[model samples]
Target: MSLGGESWRWLLASSSIPAIAVVLLRIGVPESPRWLLSQGRVDQARAVVERLRGNVEAFEDLVRNHVSARRVRYRELFGKKYWRNTAFGTIFYNAQVVPYFAIYTFLPLVLLKMGVGEEDTTSDGLLNLFLLAGSLGGLWLVAKMSRRGLTIWSFVFLIATMAPMAIWPDAPTALLFPLFLVFTFTMSAAVNLDQVYPPELFPTDLRSSGVGLLNGLSRVGSAIGTFLLPLALDGIGFSPTMLILTLVLVGGLVVSLLWAPETKNSTMD
Candidate 1:
């Protein structure tokens, strides 16, 4: 059944909310002092930190404790550690985005094929509702667990949820929607930690480059996955194809657990 007209309006309203947030960020956010230092403007960085901290003594302490702690130089992010973190972060971020796009593209198509007519957009409505709920839950998870913990648990949740979606395609809608909820919950929330986690793993000087490169590279993987999912869905069908999603989540879970160091209380100098 195709969604009734109200369903389209609901999706429009739902997506519009996030768009508003993005616009607010663009207008309201300020640049970081670390970026200034990373660009070789040490005086500008000192000025920014001094203004932020309200005392030169405290700022100097930060420079000594955090900024100058690294002897390899922040510029050495072009070296091995940066490359390793960037590569891992990029690959993992990409893995995270794949299932999201897969759902965006495949879910409606699947619903359409499964006998949802043009007049009913129940699947779309259900998806939008779950997405909102997942987002709210993710915010709570972040508030309660810290970003790193949520990042870890997001992958774990993804792995656990993928099992049901893979094995029980024939299940009733009530059960199936909850499985979608699990997957959507993690996928949506993972983006918050993606940028947060990588920079924490890198030194303060190289943080921006590390985060930028990783985020950029992950999108490449997402693009590839987006292109490939339809082909996989066409050839392998739902259950077998979705198992690939399960495996991807499993890989992400393993990779994240192994490589992502905890950064809950850490901060840049």
Candidate 2:
């Protein structure tokens, strides 16, 4: 049954429950020990560490010997030493998220073009479940595979899956559905690396600022792509739109091969 009328209002309003829960839960969260140490609250930092783990001696020694009090400026991300990381992060993140948000935002339209109507909630729900499974699989892959390998392979698989839809937009729903399931799975799996890479790319000093800037830029890219997607779909139709999105994935693959660093099992410094 298609939901109509004020059902959207309830759906929209229900989002606030999670928002309120997050706010409440955040109240009990402890401050980051590194940030605390950076602020020179040695005792408080040690206390926080002690609360979390039994052995605080190693943490204490590392803080005393290695860390220094310093504030990182956002402009430093563009400097020669860090510029490559910043560039890679910005491009890779935008590349994935742009098509990701665009497709999910207009999924119903895309599905309709592929012979699956909007009212086929069974397919939609299945796609969502595949996304969740892919996410869990991605977390496991992080432990089993190197960061660079996982990133590069995920992009490769994403392109492979999406290429079919681009080439055969009028393929029967039977074929299209399976292709879409693979695309959604690979896309969500690759997205897990978004959380893995940025912090590793920068040192502790610049971690927060670098991640913040990359995340902000990604939002802008996603918003622009989301805004333009419907126009592209309406103007050029499904096959061409899928072709364009596939190109975006190709760009990500190229950049990942060139710039994605191997941070797995590497020092944060």
Candidate 3:
């Protein structure tokens, strides 16, 4: 933990240890029954499914119909029928990350700009914990809420929260924290929708492709936003940066309004 010159390496390695634990935990887990069935190992699939569900015979038709044996083709993602889904997923993902990542990656600096002392170390950790709690709360709410409604409202709230910072750049230092929490909480909910909606938008063959494309686009957006934010902060100043990010959220709202399909209560084909 106290590697002197290698302290930076320790910081980089912090998450790897937990990842190793996950790999170890997953090693003993059985292969998915649906996967086995798709592979033509009907007996093994039946055994696994029956062991888990106690009624494989009853669910056999459903599994056979639902799980496909065909490999996922990258080309299919760009095909006419699937292209909209691809674009929607990519844009939906980009919509959230561009602003959210900018805010997240620069929050400490933003706080400092708001007159919070540089030595205030506890705020970041506390804020992250609160954000994580909000994410979990959003996870719980997902089952009850429609994806389109949830996503639209989340973007609306994102715009609402950022509006204050954009309008009153020199706002009272006390107001920053609460406004930031609201923004983070709403953004987290939208992120949850980002994770949920993309896969559902595609069918079995294209689902992974859709989700992967969304995540890749999201990472790119995050990288670009993160890289640009400091320059924006220094060049145009904080209020303009806030307005830009608010516009990014507005883009998400527009996309959700125009393109996001309601998958709620509808069967995934």
Best by TM-score: 2
lDDT (10s digit) by residue, model 1, range 1-269: 14785787787789989898899889834456566655556677787766676567765665555443344454565575566566567657876887777667667665543345545666667667777877776666665776556766888878787777678777776676666666776677666666466777676656666777777777777787788878887898877778898888788777767766666677653
Candidate 1 pairs with clashing backbones: 1-115, 1-116, 1-117, 2-117, 2-118, 2-120, 2-121, 3-120, 3-121, 4-121
Give RMSD to native, each candidate. Answer: 4.7, 1.6, 2.9
Q: In model 3, which residue pairs have backbone atoms overlapping below 3 Å?
A: none
Q: Which 10-residue window in model 3 sums to the lowest lDDT?
A: 59-68
What TM-score would every model get versus the actual structure?
0.75, 0.94, 0.87
Worst 10 residues of 1 by lDDT: 66-75
By lDDT, rank the candidates, best first.
2, 3, 1
Candidate 3 lDDT score relative to the true structure:
0.80
lDDT by residue (tens digit), candidate 2, 1-269:
24778787888899999999999989968887777777788788888888888468788676768657777777889998999999999999998999999999888888898898767889999999999999998888888999889888988888898888999988888998998999999888888888988888998788888999999999999999899999999999889888998999899889989999899888665
TM-score winner, 2 or 3: 2
Which candidate has the highest lDDT of all? 2
The all-Cα superposition gives candidate 1 an RMSD in Å to the true structure of 4.7
Backbone-clash count (model 3): 0
Candidate 3 deviant stretches above 4 angstroms: 1-6, 30-32, 54-58, 63-72
Model 2 / residue 249 / CA error / Å: 0.8
Whole-model Cα lDDT per candidate? 0.69, 0.88, 0.80
* Model 2 TM-score relative to the real fold: 0.94
Clashes of each: 10, 0, 0
